[model samples]
Target: MKTLTSLLLPLFFFAASAASAAPTANSILGASDAIRNPGGAFSVTVTLTEFQAGKQVDASTLTSYSRTQSNGQFASLVQFVLPARDAGKLMLKNGNDMWFYDPLSKASVRLSPQQRLLGQASNGDVATVNLAKDYTAVLSGEEEVQNGERQLRKAHKLALTAANPDVTYASIEMWVDAENNRPIKARFFADSSRLLKTAYYRRYQPQLGAERPTETVIIDGLDPKSVTIMRFSDYAARSIPDTWMQRDFLPRFQPE
Candidate 1:
């Protein structure tokens, strides 16, 4: 009886270990996403600073109000708040559709997620995104990668392919912290597998309900000298009305 018990205990332990080793790739991506943004409707202010060849070039600030939709994706209304020229301009993203509205011209134009906003920052970067809902993730491997702070972290690497045609990038290679599922870094790729930019997420701070990354450093894939720093602050949970996400409502929107 003792011999049999010992053998069963070892088998039980092995099974437990194996079960914990394999987590669904989508779940892993979701965990990382939670660390990037709160799961509920929220607003955040983003400051984008552009640099070229290690010299400061330009900067802008924007406020984003975002809510998760029934499809498990995010619908975002972004308002430009800085640089007198761009103030009152707005960007709306609902489902797979994106539009840019200019108050001066009263013109609403469609926007592609790939459209550059500032330096390495794109129209998609400022908006809150639920990547697990937009892409299919495959566990590529596990390795040690450098985080934004230049410290090495053990991470699970995922290769993500867009589930539909509307996503910002055709594919992405992401590294998430293996222990806590924090997003460490990612490389965005075009449809042709061309590297677009590499982003490192760091400066984590307690916000909303979780520890979220407060800063992102984006480096241009082609021009190693070009860099963009995106900083998030003033995060707060808010009730976003459905009307705020409408294209026509952009013209009548009032800032609070």
Candidate 2:
């Protein structure tokens, strides 16, 4: 009986350890998204700066309001704030469709998620969407990565595969902080599996009832000298009406 009990104890402990070590990919992705979006309607200003050869080249700013619907989807309205020529330009995202409106032309044109916005940032980057709802996540492993200060930080590495055709990136490799579930780094990939860009989340600040990354720095995958920094500020809860989410309402909509 003693011999049988010893064998069973070892097997039980091994199984328990394996179960604890393996975290479900969906749960991890969901937790990370919750930290980012927080399932509420809010407003924020994003300032994008472009750099070339380590020098500042150009910059733009935009204000956006986002709200999550009952179906777990997001609706957002974005209006360009800086750069006099582009001021009053509006972009609206309703589910998978994105539309850009120009006041001068009085036209609204459809846009693809892959289209570039400033430098490394994309039109899709401004859209408020939950990635966990769009992609299927697979826990690849965990590793230590160097932070902005060159200090080692442990993170859970995840490989995210797009479940449908509407997503911006076909596949994404992301690293989430092991303890807080904050996304530390991410690599965006094209359909052909080519690396498009790399983004690093930094300068975490309290916003919309949670601590979130206030700035995102993106680097060009092919050209290491090119960089873009997006600074987020003025986060507050706002009331976004249903009329603002419709594409046909773009001409009549007015920014508050």
Candidate 3:
């Protein structure tokens, strides 16, 4: 979550307000037969590395939580270390809330929903995996793909965009399943020139009763040199109690 997408949107626009409807797990999967976990619970452990003008700079871990079928409803915790600055922690919520907890002061900055402004917050545009509710989704095409011995149907380029006319990313391209409508791969960009980032969903196995992406990869863009690659491990799909995600969890991780 310390990657570019996490900070990019919140720093740019305010979070999307509640009341708008979100997409169902069926629709978000991208194809009718696209694989998805039943009941929608998931978790992962990720590693992130920072780069400077392509040089390695820093690295850390990212913790994630989410419901399989819902959008803008996930949480991410990130760790950052630098040669000069003290290490820091960053937390983000789909409702457009982000918290910055510093190890040096043991203090945190909680952004109000009003002041917590960022453009890419709503549509999952700024993050690696988009789960926004307002974007227009399109099933562009299809292709035959084989993974090991399994021949899976991939929904080619299922694009989605915000309804607003003036936006940064013209479209988001994703490959999903034609049968299930679940996404296998997705890409985000600025206009047609710059490829900001891409996410790869793999190591998908059955958990509980459905299939889900246990492993994720996030590619960094041109600016903000420090991190080059970020990936998740210890992935799982299961029910998570709300009590485990309290706002005050920040204090528990404060360096003593």
Candidate 4:
């Protein structure tokens, strides 16, 4: 009886531990965000390319610097670097508010987070995202999604609703790899519950001491031929000044 009791006790404890370790929706989202934005301050260059009818239509590059605040929110500054005509334009995000600065006119205007930057990519898309902070996550279920090579990968699907009105999407459906917590795919939805675009995270590479997706492909739901690819590169840790987060300082701000 003593020998049987000892074996059963260990098995009972093991089952209890496994049940407690089960991940919640919010925990999964938070883990995924931490993997993407690992530190408090960082800078990366993103190249956005637009394709239509299987042909490259437009391309632009932007450098962005972001800092995470004590309140667990992020402030980012983006500067366009390519195509002379679009060069020098700046976008700044401090919390939920965002502003766009036109260097040529020296004017700063309020912008919506949903406003398109290039092709299917939105102004909000380029900014640093903390999903757990902005959205209320619910564990929808588990499913298999196709990877870049069209191979099925098991993932946990999450349905997210905006916690506040300031967010770009009214709701979002996301899939994270069950094994690594890497974001596999996402579908953005409008206020009317209409599907806006689908995004696929691919090309995992080492960046800032972590393996993360180096490329994000967004496909337009309205027009299947329209596609946007955002390539992330040149990631490095850097200090972002408080003044750069202000709209008034955008005109004088220069890319480092």
Candidate 5:
């Protein structure tokens, strides 16, 4: 017997096709090209531990980041990020699939339709799956937040729904800065009811001629006792090989 989640998979695929049907590249981009031009790979490390509403966590997550230029004449800018937890583990996306390889477990998980599920449902919404058919993003309003003593403007919120029929999401709202075209705060709910996941960004800096997120913290109710803090260090420009992007190459992804 198929589980409830798995049972819903086929239905979601069909629904994804219908919802995404006849949507051309120009239509997908809507009125802006920001999402289509996320730029090239970036080197990053993140530490995440406990972030309860009122609890202290003691763990750190160190990971690496990489992205590719998108397809077409402007496809290269449809960039992505690779955040690996260790020397032997990694998260990467080719064109249609997102691969998460855990060498310790000797298990490689691939999220198909690799463009939709980003920043969407389940696994605390931090698994970084790249399934393209899993989400539809709607730009919300805008707001201002006090970052230190300076007033910073942000995109306010975006309501992301699971594009797959089998998978369901409550709601995931991300606050991105309009001026900088970057994310500042993100929150996820379950069944659109409860606060299940939350992630926010702070401390931005220039690396590789781009303004990027430097400090990120993700805390989920699934394990409320822990908060994860990521510290991105040693930012530099260097090309990471294609073989390193392979699912089986996760165990050999060594940072230099």
Candidate 6:
């Protein structure tokens, strides 16, 4: 009996340690956020490509400048860089407010984060955001989910609901890689509980001192045939001034 007790004692201790070390849902979300976004201010060029039924339709390029606020939120300025016709157009996200500026009209119009920018990509999608700040997360379970490469990966599924009204989506179901805490996939939903889109973060590459997902594939929830690919490149640490994030500065803002 003494020998059996000794053998089981080590097993019990190991089990207890494992349980205590398990990450909470909020911590997992925070880790995933760190993997998705770089710390501090930076700039990256984004190319959005739209596809319908596997056929290419439209494409555009934009440069996004982002700065982290003292409150741990992001303020962004996205400028349209491609297609001469749309050149000089700007979108600014400051706190809960979002605005779109058109140089032609010299007008800045209020916009919603849910507004579609390109294909299935929303105005919120292109901007720098930290999900852990905007939503409250709950761990659902661990499961095997299909990745962007069509391979199965063990992921931690998390259910998230908006902590405030200023978020892009009302609720989201996300899956993060269990091993690395990298974001795998997410399903975005509207306030009416309607499915909006599904996003898969894939194509990890070295960018801005970390291995971040360089490409995000977004699929329309209702129509899987409609897709948009958002590719990130030309990453560099940049100093974004406070004036740049202001809507009034959009007209005078000149790209350097």
Candidate 3: worst-modelled 10 consecutive residues by lDDT: 114-123
TM-score of each: 0.94, 0.93, 0.54, 0.93, 0.56, 0.93
Worst 10 residues of 4 by lDDT: 146-155
lDDT of all predictions? 0.93, 0.88, 0.49, 0.91, 0.49, 0.94
The residue ranges of model 4 lying beyond 4 angstroms of the native Cα positions read 1-15
* Candidate 3 to truth, TM: 0.54
State in Å the error of residue 97, model 3: 2.3
CA deviation > 4 Å runs, candidate 5: 1-38, 51-56, 69-134, 143-155, 164-170, 191-193, 221-226, 251-256
lDDT of 2 at 33: 87
What tens-digit string does per-residue lDDT give for candidate 4 at 1-256?
Answer: 5798897999999999998999999999998998777578899999999999789999999998999987897898998989889888999899989999998899999999999999999999999878899999999999999965466899999999999999999999999989889988999999999999999999988998889889999999899899999999999998788888998798789766
Largest TM-score belongs to which candidate? Answer: 1
Cα lDDT of model 5 by residue, 1-256, tens digit: 8799998999999999897773332233232223312245545444444444555534434444455534421110111233344545555555434666666797777654222222222222333232223456765555675432245664445666666443325455665555544566666666646876566666667755656566666565476544555545566555666665566665666665
The residue-by-residue lDDT of candidate 2 on 16-92, one tens digit each, is: 99999876888888888887775778889999999999899999999988999877978889999999889989999
In angstroms, the error of model 5 at 184 is: 2.6
Candidate achieving the largest lDDT: 6
lDDT of 5: 0.49
Put down candidate 1 lDDT per residue, 162-242, tens digits, no spaces: 999888999999999999999999999999999999999999999997898999999999998999999999999989998
For residue 198, give model 5's deviation from the true position in Å.
Answer: 2.1
**TM-score between model 2 and native:** 0.93
